[model samples]
Target: MFINSKGYYIPTKRVDNNYFAKLNDLSEDWYFKRTGILTRARASEEETINYMSIKAVENAIKNLPYDIHEVDLIVFASYTPNDTVGTTAHIIQKEFNINNAKAFYISSACSSAINGMEIINSFFKSKISSKALLICADRNSSYSDDRDTQSGHLWGDAAVALFFSSEPIRPNEASILDINTLGLGNVGHGPQAVTMEPKNGLHMPYGKDVFTHACVYLARLTDTIIKKNGYSISDLTYFIGHQANKRILNNVCHELGLAENKSLSNVEELGNTGCASAPLVFAQNYDIFKEGDLVCLSVFGGGYSCGTCLIKFN
Candidate 1:
């Protein structure tokens, strides 16, 4: 699908590393040394997941040439839900006053946006819809315990929206060429490493293991997509990864011989927004890429999931 436009919303309350360090009883530098996150934003009570998501889509539709009511489908992605029953996609659709559009939600952890795009790609290829909307939102601050040291300081609130068309709405629009994904779920392997308990309903992720897997697997997944698509490593112009960890992204770029400038990230300043990370990065950086430039997106997170998509700018 051709990307017509995108919109991003990051919470206004910015918390610095010092804030997390004090809570963890560690030095400020320790936050950087380990997670590489310096600051992150937290959503206010008024800025609920659906609120931010609707705001994001408002900006997206405003920027695009299409009407909101004309959108044929909506795919929503989120890891942190504000409720137990209602799907956020349906909420967004109803708020948009769109009754005819088909909508669904995916909670595929951090790789959710990529998975959403994959579904959009298929719809375009199958000629099922001419226009679609994809929204990824995460309000991780709601679920994370502020007093906990491990998973507490590692999340940010964010929402990103993308409008897609089967054909380019503009001559210079960027479009996804392919999406490759991997899900390794052994009987006891994946979710055990990163989980939210039913008893306490708190996020509990094994940081070191997640970091190790993120670096190696994201690198491999990215490389595999590039090569399989007949694009040389030298052909990639930008790498927008999931805002999981700055260190993991850096290591992946280093392994691929990619320069620092070629890799774009917000993890240091925005923490990890789970599913919204990659799309938010893309919405912010897509204009920097020149026509015909090949850009790659790679994301890894819980469910032991990793996904990569290669996009071509026209």
Candidate 2:
């Protein structure tokens, strides 16, 4: 499938490291040295997951190549659901008045977006849909506790919208060359590394374990995807890893022998945006991607999942 249009919405409220420092009694440098984040975006009461998602879709569809009614599939990929029963996907479908579309929600932690995209790929390959909309978003602030020192400061709110078609709708669109995803429920700390209980809020009991495993799996997925596609690391024009941490992404670049200059990220400014991280970076830098450029999106998420997507800009 070809990604025809992309857009994102990052809340305007900025929460700096000092805010966390005061709340957790940790120095600002300690937070930055560990996570490589200076500030993060926090959504307001009005900026719900569904609201941010719709705003992102509006930004993406500004230059839409097809009618909204033609979109046969709508997927909302997020772990922080506004309403589990009435999914954000259905909200979007109804808001846009999409008359004939199948809407659903899926989540695999931060890897939700990649998994959603893979499902869309299958739908197209099976001739189940010609046009699709994938909205990946997270309202991390809703679940995180500012007083918790471990993972409370690692989250930021954001959303991204990606429009896909079975065939290229425009010459400048990017083609999905290949996608690879894995469920690592038994790897490293597994499901115990991160947990979000309704009463306990979001907490990371195994921060060190997550960093170690994320570095390994993200690089592995990126390298495996590139090599299996008969391409070398040198051919990659850009590398966008999961925006969980700048340190993790930098380590992945080092392991893959990819230059840090070619690695693009917003984690330093936006912090970790959950499932919206990688795609948000893509949408933010969409204008700079040149024709024939090879871009790789590698991600690792809390459910102990990792995935990679190789795209070729046309």
Candidate 3:
């Protein structure tokens, strides 16, 4: 599978680190340095998940050669769905009048989009579908709790869409080389690592523990995939991890002996858009890679699920 095109929808509203610094009574430098976030986009009341998803897909295909009818499937990834009964993917299908395609959702939190890509690759290879649109979107601003300032400061709202095909859609594109996902539930850290209550809708995460765990596990997962695929750390041109925080990515790179510049990080401006973080950062930084460049896409999410993808630019 290869990406033919990518589309991104950034929300209109912006919240700078200063906003959180003042709210949490921390120095501006402290929050910005620790989180590596300067500003984060926020969704307004009018910006629903489905709306952003469709708009992103529209943006993805707008410059491409294919018509809307050619898209046979859509995989929507998000944890911030507005309605439980209404599926965002199916809604996008209807919005684009993709009459023949089937749509669905994935709720693996920050890993949803990466996981969706893995699934779509298999679907294409199996001939279950072709020319699929993968959209990773989140409206995290809607779920922010006034008391949970940590999470409030870390998450933002945005969506990313990508056009994927089994056949080479473009002469210049990144082919899906390999994807490996693993679920290490809770990891004995209990539910305190990350949890969202269904009753009051609060996102509670233990900062220190989550920080330590994320850095260690993400590095291990990336290393595992790299070796399992017979590729070494030096073989990867760019390492794109979940843009959860600048500190985490930096630490992971340091552990791998990988240069910080080789890793694509957009957390400074975009904050962590959950599952949308990695793909949005990847698309935005795609031009930095040379043809045939090796890239590794890795992500660790709330469920203690982590994955890595090895890709070769086409």
Model 3 lDDT at residue 190 = 37
Scanning candidate 2 in windows of ten residues, the lowest lDDT window is: 196-205
**In candidate 3, where is summed lDDT lowest over 10 consecutive residues?**
184-193
Number of clashing pairs per prediction, in order: 0, 0, 0
Better of 1 and 3 by lDDT: 1
User: Please, what are the lDDT tens digits per residue for candidate 1 over residues 188-299?
Assistant: 2578767776555446556777787888888888889999999878889999888887888889899898897899998988998889998899888866888888989999
lDDT at 179, model 3: 85
Writing each residue's lDDT as its tens digit, candidate 3 over 220-294 gives 988988898888999888899998899999999999999998988888888888889888888787677788798
lDDT of 3: 0.82
Better model by lDDT: candidate 2 vs candidate 3: 2
* Order of candidate numbers by lDDT, starting with the best: 2, 1, 3
Cα RMSD for predicted model 1: 1.6
Clashes of 2: 0
lDDT at residue 146 of model 2 (Cα atoms) = 88
**What residue runs in model 3 are displaced by over 4 Å at the alpha carbon?**
190-192
Which candidate has the highest TM-score of all? 2
Question: Considering lDDT, which of the candidate structures 1 and 2 is the better prediction for this target?
Answer: 2
CA error at residue 117 for candidate 3, angstroms: 1.1
